[model samples]
Target: MLIREWMATDVLTVDENTSMMKALHLMKENKIRRLPVMSHGKLVGIISDRDLKEASPSKATTLDVHELYYLLAEIKIKEIMTKNPITIQPDETIERAAVVMLENKVSGLPVVNGKSELVGIVTQSDIFRAFVNITGIYRGGVQFAFSLDDRPGSIKEVADTVREHGGRIVSILSSTDMAVEGTRNVYIRIRNLPQEDLENLEKTLRQKFRVIYMVKDILKTV
Candidate 1:
């Protein structure tokens, strides 16, 4: 999925000259953690709640309420904001955005257009929601993990076996990262499986392949 389809378009932004107090207030009122700092309708910097907290007066400070307020008002967002922060294009894939976020150690990225105008924001929450949807977790199907050879038709064989047992496949994901050479790990999510047939299917699958794990709600049946 692309970022434009999932990113929050109605983003809350602040001017570079915005005071720390005002920025903090904006974050609190909107219930968001980060704000894109704009200058002359262009993206310039980014600030987050943590930055504001770090810039704030410490709890043990002897400064009075008026002094604290003055200090906050005098501090501009540009003073502590991350300059020229890492950004992602709206048309970029979600996986690319996730990679950028991981490499930068940031939770969110400002989405920009080709003209460099800020259009939206993509956060960790957005990526997580996309992952859940892609995995079909909410469909609540039985998930099976198997170790299979890397040769052609290996996945098809497992799928054919599942269908033969009257099980409907919901999703299938495979990875070679954790498998030994010449083999890969395949995870399949299936539904419409009868409880009485589960044991026999497991036994049959074990005979043909290595069944690594199975996850299902035992109390529920198709």
Candidate 2:
């Protein structure tokens, strides 16, 4: 999925000259954690709740409430915002956006167009929703996990078995990260099989492959 399809287009922003107090209020009012910092109609930096906390007076400070409020009001977002923040393009794939966020240790990203105009924002929550959609978890299917050799038709054999038993395939995901060399782990989501057929299907699959686990419902397993 592309970033444009999932990113939040109704972005909230703060100007470089915006006071820390105002920024904090903006975040609270909108129930958001981050805001893109803009200057003279151009994207310049980004600020998050952590930055606001850091800019605020420490809990142990001896300053009076009025003094603390005054200090925060005088602090501009530009002074604490991360300059030249990492960004992602709206046309980029969601996988690419996730990789960037992971590498930078950031929970969110500002989406920009080719001309560098701020278009939207993407966050960890958005990526998670994309994952749920990609895995077909919301459809509620029976899932089976297997450890199989990385040879051709290995996946097809499993798929054919499900099809033969009146099972409709929903999603198939495989990875080699946790498997022994020359073998990989596969998770297959299928639907339309009755509980009675599960026993025979499991027996048929175990004859040629190792069944790691099986779940009657994908949503519950997740």
Q: What TM-score against the true fold does each predicted structure earn?
A: 0.94, 0.94
- lDDT for position 103 in model 1: 90
lDDT of each: 0.92, 0.91
**Reference-based lDDT, residue 153, model 1:** 98
Q: How many residue pairs clash in each candidate?
A: 0, 0
Q: Residue 60 in model 1: shift from native, Å?
A: 0.8
List model 2 lDDT by residue over 1-222, tens digit each: 899999999999999999999999999999999999999888999999999998788999999999999999999999999999999999999999999999999999999999999999999999999998888866746788999999999999999987887778889999999998999999998764667887788788888688999887544555
lDDT of 1 by residue, 79-157 (tens): 9999999999999999999999999899999999999999999999999999877877667468889999999999999
Model 2 misplaced stretches (Cα beyond 4 Å): 217-222
Model 2 residue 170 lDDT score:
81
Instruction: Estimate candidate 1's RMSD in Å.
Output: 2.6
